[model samples]
Target: MAQEQAGRVLRSVKWRADLTAGVLATWPADPRKRTSQEWEQVRTAIPGGEGLPSSVIKGRTRQAVTFLNANGRLPVDVFELEGAPRVPRMLLLAACDRQQATIERGDTDPGRVMLRLQLPTRVDPHAYGDWTWVACPISLPPMVPVSAVLHLPTLRVTGRQVRADVAYTHTVPKAKRTGHTVAVGVDWGLNTLLSAGALRLQADGRITALGAGGQFRAAGVLAKQHRLRRLSERLHAKADHYQRLTAGDQQHDLAGKHAVLSDEIQHVSARRANLNDALAWAAARWAVDQAIAAAATVIYVEDLGSMEAKGMGRSLNTRLSQQVRGKIVDRMRHLAAEVGVAVVTVPCTRPERGRVHFPVRRCEPTTSDRPHL
Candidate 1:
């Protein structure tokens, strides 16, 4: 009896593997005719697929063909059973409506839902005896419109565990503006991270400061700069050492050492980049929050399209390049939109002949107007 039960388990595993392969192989030439006779021909061609239900074959074929049509290729590699390939957990489509699966409230606790799945009895008739039901406990979100269900594998140390993911859809309401029209002028600076002035434009061509002078300092900016400088010096020394070894005829494993040093430098550079991104995000969030608190309806920032890091010292140029000014602007814009605040970019144009008026007022005097630090 034990030997017979072991044989039944083996057959059930093979059945699932074959089913996955058969579904992938049946990618239709025309996805529009998914339920047509073409799928039946493809299913019969695949071994062990003849025993599968028509509903199962049709659902798998539709999904595979739709993916191929949308992407112009398969999303994943073609399924294969040879070489003991991993069989992904299968999703039994049209479960509740087709009576292949049933969900009910738990008798002991009404809040918990119990799921029962019907296994394929055609593969092995006596595998699960008369009642072929596999029970699973699940919890669902309140009032969520569940459209589809997905079967996923669970991390198990001993016994088997099955997980189900329910896909749902939700909608978000649009945002509407409130309060009076207020504007904030934002300026990106090298010394201070961001300088913002919250003000209101008067009808008599004047600006009134509501709440001005909010500046955010760049966190970890100097630390990242110091770390990068150290890494650069170390990399330079390693390169010189590698060059000296290569110049001589003496055999040395300088190539491996050079590669290792290069990898370390790259890792340090990546960490610096990650730190810069975090700092930029935090600074932008704080700036937007300050603007929102002042009831600013619009934010005006300089469009740095004509700006370049040229003519500056190498160290200063490198710092400016890594500053990611564009990313800061984008982050601020995204955050501002969430609160119904509009972000506008004005060109950084010079005052030409008879063109002295500007849209946004500068909080501080220009660098040419002030003495060097």
Candidate 2:
């Protein structure tokens, strides 16, 4: 009676998104391979389009859907969507990979679909062993399936899936000045990416800029990547011709082309990886170095987990794109803490009410005017 009472009192959307991946594990292969139009039909025609959980069911290991008569082998996962489990609905998504095609816009109706996948995989990007966590089977709840609409303006229907992983992350401010302290104000701007002050906090508790000119190192790296691509194409063409001669009368031009393409792909991939590493390292080093110079224990940083933050999207700034900042900030916090420094992220905005604006905390906090960070 006690267990039933508790379950009845608390009704949740299953906010923990890991639910989708858990449910799809037992579902069979694509019963009816769906086209774009067919997928669209299912969405609009299906009951409770944006009110059900999206679930993903991957195999215990990898397996290809060889059953489909297509050019390339595709992986299949059975999924379920349910707003209320009492009358849950199931959908089978066949060709939902990166490369998908639709004839007419209306024919292919479903939007960007995000299926909850249950894989025995998680990532630990930081080399430091602090805050490393694994999602054991028991740790995460069941999985669900949900699709997000793409074409409609002002309509970001995130399917019927709930974000269970959503939660507030911040450190309570506890900064006891051990010696002379400096507060560095970092301003993230569009034209000028990041503005760092040489002397963050002045003797009279005023924030001042250090360098005269703005740093434009990121632009130089972008130019190098473009130049490398051009050079790589020329090299690949020359290499392909030479490689083709190695095969005689039965000379396989396809084999030569494949080898050249594979090498070029690796080169481009490695270059991009290096660029991202450089940016992450630069941000991490800057924050740590500023804290050390301030003669203070802890650093107050901006938390971008809130919804309304502008540059957090993928298009604007490569460094600020995706959820990389969250991981990077976590790594920096642990690194700072290890050296007796407190790293606290001040709340930027209230996400639930649709405000992700962070109140800018600067070098001189003990002042009347709000310092433009």
Candidate 3:
């Protein structure tokens, strides 16, 4: 009787695996034809597909449909297996209505939370009788509920790692401006990465200079550029040497040496990128910190969208563009949002009567007689 029961369990597992593989194989090429009507049509065409659960079939069909709609086509390969092809890792769909998967804190150990995956008996009757519950330990932030779970094998790593992506909604408190109203004007330039001027807005519509000429230095940018240039030259020399050797001698193998030089070139290129990213972030942080220290609620930055680097040499243009002023602005905007400070971009117009007036309320020009700044 026990041997017969084990054989039945094995057969059930194999059936589920075959069913999943079949569903993936018959995935619709047209994303529009992935509705319930289409799924039923395709399922009826496949032999033994009628025996599969409607819920499972719908879930698999929905997954494939979503992928097709987003990427404009199906994935190149569906089943990414590791060792044995017959026993594949299942991408089980969670039924929210049935509560097949749930997250809750431990009863005895309050700190220890767990994710419970309840397998339905319809998939496997004998082994997973009625409803088989498997509890896996998990850690999550306080009061955050799990929305969905994606089951997939770990890539390029050892041991099983279940990554749960959780999302929650929180209200942001209104900012209370208790201090005096201050505004900071920022000018982005090639020589000085950022030049900031702090001003205090008075009640009588008068602006006083609290501080002026604040700058953030793009340190080590030139040095890194020089290093990258040298690395490129070395890479070219090595490539030339390899080509000459390969052309002259057919016996000697220079593949290993060529690969080493290529790898070194790539490493230097990556290092240069890393350095540039670090500098951009650092400059942004400095600008934000200066604004915070000055108690400025509003920061006005020069908009460089329409500004052209005309009459400049190729080398100068490359250096100016590569400085990534836009990246600095983007980072500054993100960092400023964390606090109550607002970053606004003003048009790069020339100062009228030796003073640049930024309309804080409307952000529109008062008169159209100003030159480009």
Candidate 4:
């Protein structure tokens, strides 16, 4: 019932936003710079604004303006949705309230949580006064800390289940910026995936390695990922050939084949996404474990944002381009935040011979207090 209600609200909000998009496209003023009063006036011009809550309308408009600013165009064909509801924080209450929705802990079982939603029975109603509140139990993962502060979560439906993407806040020790004594250095690899180890700075500004770190090897997963990539490429090529042969004719003989290929491509893409997500999390967990084992305060990784895959062989270049480097960095930062470890990206310089060099300060130690690299 909550999913249904939220979907309805989202559809209504999207419908209004679509109409507003069309109107804003013709205005001389920039929609991104519109004030709240200006947006309210524009909302009055929309036909179905009266049916939506003010907060929902405001959020959608602001979201649309942001999209326009980023893409330099208004969103069109916005009514097609996948049933994901982006409810505002105000509408989703953490405590018991006579509002749209409320989530609370179970009285009998502290581990169990409940979601209460107000649902309307009428076919189409402008107000929720005649709605009834219904309660349903929800499950939370065990990894959530007991002291974390809960906030309103976004909701989505998949198969026969509704999933809540809960966001929370937890206190962690602040990371140091410049006074780091111990740090981990991470190097990128293809089959080895990552090479990370700890380094310590001495009193005389000398750096030394601690121990040989472990490597994350996922040869099977990488093989599967490449296979899926090749299959998707073949499917896209065939689909393109079929499209050119049909030339926009829906009744062509190859139309069904093209449609099937498109569906297969989507399936393969979804699999790749899931695979990448798993690999990223696993790699991040391993890296954080290395840092914790070494008692390091920060992790230094080479910045690969400007690195290109060209000049390497064709297959190696493709693999490098498809590598989940960015995703791994993001996941590493998220996991490291929980333990108060800072993930810093240092600038890397590559020579003409395609050799990457990390900026490390090296000096001969006067005393044998720490191990030398």
Candidate with maximal lDDT:
4
lDDT, candidate 2, 72-111, per-residue tens: 5323322223233331222111222222211111234232
CA error at residue 214 for candidate 1, angstroms: 1.1
**Which prediction has more favorable lDDT, 1 or 2?**
1
Best by TM-score: 4
Q: How many residue pairs clash in each candidate?
A: 0, 28, 1, 0
The local lDDT score (0 to 100) that residue 347 gets in candidate 2 is 52
lDDT rank order: 4, 3, 1, 2
Candidate 1: pairs in clash? none
Better of 1 and 3 by TM-score: 3
**Is 2 or 4 the stronger prediction by TM-score?**
4
lDDT of candidate 1 over 1-373, digit per residue (tens):
2344445557866665566566666656665455556667667766755554554555555566666667786645333222344434445332234355666665676545666766655765665564466777777555332322223212123226544554322332222333334677777777687878787767775777875468887646755666686777788788778867767433666776766777777777767777767776887788778777887766777776546564789877766655667777777765665565666677644556632122643222111111110
Candidate 1 regions exceeding 4 Å error are 1-180, 203-205, 233-252, 349-373
Tens digit of per-residue lDDT, candidate 4, span 99-216:
6676667667655677778777787867757678878777767877665665555565643666676666777666655677787778899999998878888899787779776788
The positional error of residue 201 in candidate 1, measured at the CA in angstroms, is 1.9
Give the range where candidate 2 is weakest over 10 consecutive residues by summed lDDT. Answer: 364-373
Please give the RMSD to the true structure for each candidate, in Å: 19.9, 21.9, 18.0, 12.9
lDDT of 3: 0.61
User: What lDDT does each candidate get?
Assistant: 0.59, 0.40, 0.61, 0.70
